[model samples]
Target: MKFIAHINIMPKTELLDPQGKVVVKNLPNLGIQGVSDVRIGKHVTIALEAPSEQEAHDKVELACSKLLANVIMESYDFVIEAQ
Candidate 1:
């Protein structure tokens, strides 16, 4: 079976997101008010062959833990779908 995984990596909520803060602060300056709590993150998509959906999910999880995301400062989640 072949699967495609969509992953989102984001800084932990308890951690400070300087880039997000800068955007939030500047939104008002750009004449865009009422925008608050902005956050920036990364999106990743991977295609792989696996025996089962569970296997695909596990592999993607490993990829996220080992390479895609920094567990210390960032968190990640993914969804796998047949392609």
Candidate 2:
């Protein structure tokens, strides 16, 4: 079976996102308003072969924890779908 995983990696909510803050601070300059906050994150897509959905999910979780995301500073989640 072929599976596609869509992953999102984001800074822990307790941590400060400097880049997001910078954007929020400058939004008013562009005549943008009413937005109080912003947070930048990464989206990853992985396609792989697996025998089951559970297997695909585990693989994606491993990839996120081991390489794609910083476990200490970031959090991640993924959805696996047949492809």
Go through the candidates in order and give each one's C-alpha lDDT: 0.96, 0.94
Candidate 1 lDDT, tens digit per residue, 1-83? 99999999999999999999999999987799898699899999999999999999999999999999999999999999998
Candidate 1 regions with alpha-carbon error over 4 angstroms: none
Could you give candidate 2's per-residue lDDT for residues 14-55 as a string of tens digits?
999999999999999999999998999999999999999999
Clashing pairs in 1: none
Per candidate, the number of residue pairs that clash is 0, 0
Judge candidate 2 at residue 60 and give its lDDT. Answer: 91
Stretches of candidate 2 above 4 Å error?
A: none
